[model samples]
Target: MANTPSAKKAARKIERRTEVNRSRRSRVRTFLRKLEDALAAGDATQAQAAFQAAQPELMRAVTKGVIHKNTASRKVSRLAARVRKLSA
Candidate 1:
């Protein structure tokens, strides 16, 4: 129901942005899942590697505005703690 040309253009832009954001979010989730699986498997080395991989992806999502800074930091912190515990 976008009557104005500008409104239509804006709707299209939003659609494209939504798709990109969804893709980014999904990618981040996939990385997180990998980390989770590694953790659940109780393999310290694999969990550490997955944590190293996921930390950057989480920060990248934050920089891209797909996630909030504190949210990413908190996730990183919690996951890092779990990783450390596993290593210990």
Candidate 2:
């Protein structure tokens, strides 16, 4: 449906960006899942480590516009709270 040359080019660019964003989102999910698994397994040390790894990835996703900033912050806060509870 992109009749204009510029529109066609923009469509192509969107497709590429969509793929990249999808990949980034999936990677972020993987990190979150790792943290969840570690938490579920009741290993405080491992959970903490996973949380450490996931934090940056989540923030990066926010920076990249893959997810909302507040959503990322809420997730990080909740996970951190759970990690702290594990230690207590």
Best candidate, TM-score-wise? Answer: 1
In model 2, which range of ten residues has the least summed lDDT? Answer: 79-88
lDDT of 1: 0.98
Query: Candidate 2 at residue 12, lDDT?
Result: 100
Which tens-of-lDDT digit does each residue in 1-88 have in candidate 1?
A: 8999999999999999999999999999999999999999999999999999999999999999999999999999999999999999
lDDT of each: 0.98, 0.97
TM-score of each: 0.99, 0.96
